[model samples]
Target chain A: MMRVAEGSYAIADAVRCCSPDVVSVYPITPQTHIVEHLSQFVANGELDCEYINVDSEFSSLSSLIGASAAGARTYTSTTSQGLALMFEVLYNASGMRLPIVMTTVNRALSAPLSIWNDQQDSFGVRDSGWIQLYAENVQEVMDLTPQLYRISEDPEILTPSMVCMDGYILTHVYEPVEFLDPELVKEILPPFSPVNVLDPEDPKTFGAFADPSWFTEFRYLQYKAQERALDLIGKVDKQFEETFGRGYGGLIDTYRTDDAEILLVSLGSIVGTIKDAVDELRKEGIKVGLVKIRSYRPFPVETLKEALKDASVVAVIEKDVSVGYQSALLTDIKGALYNTSIRVPISGFAAGLGGRDVAMKQIRKIVENASRVKDEGLELETEFEIFDVNPECL
Target chain B: MQESLFAPGHRACAGCGMPIVIKLVLDAAGPNTIVASSTGCLEVTSTPFPESSWKVPWIHSLFENPASVASGIEIAFKKFGRTDINLLVIAGDGSTFDIGIGSISGMFDRGHNITYICYDNEAYMNTGVQRSGSTPIYASTTTTPIGTQSPGNLVRKKDMPAIAVAHGASYVATASIAYPVDLRRKVKRSLEIKGPAYIQINAPCITGWSYADGDTIEQAKLVVETCICPLYEYVDGELVGVKKVRNKRPVEDYLKTQGRYKHLFRAEGGDVYIANIQAIADRNAEKFGLLD
Candidate 1:
């Protein structure tokens, strides 16, 4: 049924439809409504799982790690410091190869402790070995919730995953989202039977100590599973689209880059605004296109190369900065093009941190600067530029 | 051969009472048990590679999340509709009394069907005798060494078994490796209950406590006898079982055996510290009816 619903409630309903056997939750801003709705569902007999209200995000993820190990489909939601508090168990979940799905409402990490939106929290633990997926809208949030489970629980890809959505932009916004039929979700998603579980009938050890001899191999196996997930993600998304009537453009969603002179790259909710700016630029006869990256961890290097092959300059627009250098997404995008046949100049513009509005003017400036850099053969002094920096504050 | 869930080929330190308590608890738990261990001595020593001494299912994750992980396993079994297997957690004092308390409290608060056994060695033994929250008052550790300006650790030891009971654990017990029959009976009784149960075993550390090579059992007995670490059980918020000490001794008997407390006897104004330590034992004796 398609109805106007808040993104959090929509996601909660989508998760309930997936029928997770265990839902562990610790409330944090922009992420609370998702779990709140899920808890109510469990309370009212709409969902039939053990709903645990944990004391902290640490325990929330830790319990999920345990539940996943024991062969249960588990889900949780958190943002910003909540995700930061869960940092250690994040690695444990993936290292143990438990296919727990988490909805990470993207928000900025704190020293000043802002409850605003940014990709910093999700990007901070990029190397924790979980598959990362960014959503551009509420519909994507609802659609991708079940697909994430399929990809994470796939025998070839038994790794934990985080479905990242811009905190308030997608998490709190109301939109009409069409949920896939519950019958279809059950038909498509199989019952979780883990390859290794804590079964006393057939006892086996999990997360056991490995010496120098076997330690590297364990990590290597985790890495290999991720490498294999690159293909599995595309297959799962395609399967989801075939089962339902919608498809997110595999790993990276490209917007009219066939013969563009400039490409603006972004992820999460800002991708929607960037797409709007791209349309306005195209109507003005400017050859500007947008590429929305959906999967960030198993970064779509080949697909990105093929998508941006014809662009003369690519401008990366994102929400997180690596403190002293280019944004994390920009760095990965540049690395994706390194030593390849594609030789287009790529630059980054970081904006919309701490929930600051990413104005269309800032995105247009990115396109205009990249176009000028290509036309006049000029090189940027810095690796990437900070978009919309207030010189008055400096 | 006796039915054993924990094998003997692992590399725990000689005279380390933790492994003995672990073996006894697991034996009582039986082969139909799954263990979630925190990162500490037992985890490091038992599974040191492709080799593991655990005869049943076991998992070792971070230090502060054994109870949370065990809670997950317990809930997972319920989700799978299987109630036959026993869910057990084994963690050190650092994990139990300090870092893992919040998680343990959460596990108990949620009322999961699992038994958590904390092998209390007082200090962080695996990390080379660092002072932890469970380290006794005025006891010396590497981080709380006796010096001219220092009087060892300043804080009192956390009463973990009471903490479990306060968190509404259905069964909470304090046991010692010195009394194997009592420890085994406590473990069996905890497993018999169908909710969160906590059993804290005062397992003495030979290296950390600077004790004799074979005095682990002796020291465990002395602490219980002195009421410094009383052996008692709580069932549904009521203290029903108490291991009454027929020959209660002064706290000096237990303190004299540990080198960590040696400074309290030899230093200037040391008797004050000794009296303060005895006061702690006196309070426990009064509270648990140990002297009677």
Candidate 2:
């Protein structure tokens, strides 16, 4: 049934359908409503699960690590500072291969703090060995919730996943999301049958210290599991589509990219505005397109190369800057296309940072720059530009 | 003898008091228990990669998360309706009194049906005897080394059991590795309680304390007998039991056994610090009614 609901409620409903055995929560802005709805579900007896009101984001994720190790499907959500506090436990969760799922409501990090939409929070922990998926809108946020669990809990890819949605843009907005059918969700995501768990009948040691001789091999296994997730993420997304009849393209989604001379690449909800800009620019005879990267970690390198192969110039727009370098997604895309046969001028534009608006005009300017580089052979002045910055601010 | 749940062949130092405390606690907890250990001496020594001393399900996560982790397991088992199995957290004093205190406080405050046991070896033994919050006053540690203008650690041990009681834990107790029966009884009793329970055991570190390998139990006993580390119990924030000392021993008797306190005897004006320590023991004796 398609019903208009807040994005957080849609996500909580999707989580409910998946039947998590444990939900540990510590409230943070933009992520609070998700847990609040889940807590209500538990309170009214609609959801029979252990709802742990933990003390901090650290404890919340730590408890889920324990709960997930004990063979329970567990979950939690947090934004900027909360996600930063959970930095240590994030590595532990993936290192232990817990298959815990978290909704990383994306927001900008602290220091001159802002509680607004940005991908910096999720991108900051990009190398923590979690499968990171970005949603373009509220519907995608709802649809990706169960798929994250399905991918993370796969027997071959026993890694945790972060379903990142732009903070207030997707979390607080009202949208007509097609709620997942619990019966069909069960088909794709069965009851969590753990390969190993904390059971008295069958004892096992978890998170044991590895000496120098063995430590690298253990890390290698974790890396191999992440490598395995690149394929499993797409396969499970396909399975989700087969069962639910709606699917975002698994790793990377493309819009009018074929036979285009210029391609714009980005992630999260900003892709919506960029798509609108692309449509306007196309009417003006600018051969521009958009490649929405859904899965960021186990970064869709091969699929990205294939998508941007034929472009005359590729412009990357993102909400996070690596600060001293180009945007994170831009750097990854540059590295992906580095050794490949696809040789083109790639420019990066950092926009929408700290929830600053990435309007259609700014996106149009980025495409015009990329088109100028392609058509008139214009040389860029800097490595990347902060696209929306006012000249007076500097 | 039933086969010990904590198997041998791990790498704890000879006469290290932690293995004894772990063995006793696990023996009391039995096979129907899961353990969440913090990163400390016991976790590093007992489970190094491919080898684990635990015969029961055990997990060691971070330095200060064992209590929260144990809460997770306890509530998870509750969701499973498997109330027979016990959830136990075994951590070190560095984990309990210092870094892990917030997580522990949260665990107890939430009233999770779990028992947290802190093996207080007085310092951060795994990191080579750095002074921790549980380190006693005037005792020398790597972080509080004896030098000019410095006798030793200037701070008293943090009262973790009292803090536990303040959190409204159903049962809070302190034990020493010197008395196996007393420690085991407290472990079993804590498990029997309906809600959160806390037990701190003063397990002497053979290496960190620089004591003779064979003197761990003697040092443990002497600390209690001198009224420096009293054994007592609180039931729901009320003092219910105290382990009385029939004849109180001099504080020097306990201090002389460990090298950590050797500075109190050798350093100039060391007698003054020793007298201060004696005063601390006397205060503990009077407060706990240890002589009664």
Q: Count clashes in each candidate, considering only residues at least 3 apart in sequence or on different chains.
A: 0, 0
What's the TM-score of chain A alone for every prediction?
0.98, 0.98
**Top lDDT model:** 2
Cα misplacement distance, residue B202 of candidate 2 (Å):
0.6
Checking candidate 2 for backbone clashes, the offending pairs are: none
Tens digit of per-residue lDDT, candidate 2, span A1-394: 9999999999999999989999999999989999999999999998999998988999999999888889889999999999999899999988898999999999999877999888888999999988899999988887888888888988888999989999999889997889888988888887898989999999999999988999899789988988888888888888888988887889999998987999999998999998898889889988889999998998888999889889898888899988888789888898998998888888898889899988898888888788888875637433488777788997
TM-score of each: 0.97, 0.98
DockQ for all models, in order? Answer: 0.81, 0.84
Displacement of residue B172 (Cα, Å) in model 2 is 0.6
lDDT per residue for candidate 1 within B1-292, as digits (tens), equals 4667888888888999988998889878788889999999999899887888888889987999999998888887887789888888999999999899899889999899999999999999999999998999999999999999988999999877878888889999999888888898999999898899999899899999988888889999999988888899999889998999999899998898889999988999889999998999999999989877
C-alpha RMSD of each candidate structure in angstroms: 1.5, 1.1
* Model 2 spans with C-alpha error above 4 angstroms: A376-378
Where is model 1 chain B poorest over a 10-residue stretch in terms of lDDT?
A: B1-10
